[model samples]
Target: METTNEFERYQKAKKQVEDIKGFYGHLASYVLVMGLLIFINLRYTPQYLWFVWSMLGWGIGLFFHAMKVFNWFPFFNKEWEEKKIKQYMEEEKKTNKFE
Candidate 1:
């Protein structure tokens, strides 16, 4: 039993680490690509700054990605789902008892 719990914890930790790593990788790619875009836009068309649009769009996506990885919205996660399911089950049990 102890070993099983330890294994589960290990898996959870591993998954969390992977999530963090994935976020960092995404950030790195964004930085590199945006840097290139900045150079291209400034060098070729100094009057038209179009990189801002791409940055805004991709930044929004990245922000959402970070939120999911960091669990900023806890209500949408696995633990919350499990808790809600159990709560409903308990309510059903109480109703059945009365019946």
Candidate 2:
């Protein structure tokens, strides 16, 4: 049982590492592609400067991806939500006892 649990944990950790690696890979690709787009836009249509649109759009997505990979928003994280739920339930129990 312990060995199985350990293996499960190891697998979970490995998966998480893979997810982080994938996010970084995505980020690298975004940078490379956006850089190329910017170069093309500047070389071909400097007056219009339309590459900013794609840059901003894809940048927002990459920001969210990075946030998810790094667990940046603590308030919305799963463990924090679970802890808050348990605390609220305990407080409700205490209040009911007093009532």
Q: RMSD per prediction, one decimal?
A: 1.8, 2.4
Tell me the TM-score of each prediction against the true structure: 0.87, 0.76
**Candidate 2 residue runs with Cα over 4 Å from true position:** 84-99
lDDT of every model, 2 decimals = 0.95, 0.92
User: Clashes in each model (backbone N, CA, C under 3 Å)?
Assistant: 0, 0
Model 1, runs deviating above 4 Å? 91-99
Over the stretch 12-94, how does candidate 2's per-residue lDDT look in tens digits?
Answer: 89988998999999999998999999999999999999999999999999999889888897677778999999999999999
Residues 1-99, candidate 1: write the lDDT tens digits. Answer: 999999999999999999999999999999999999999999999899999999999999999999989999858888999999999999999999988
Best candidate (score: TM-score): 1
lDDT of 1 at 85: 97
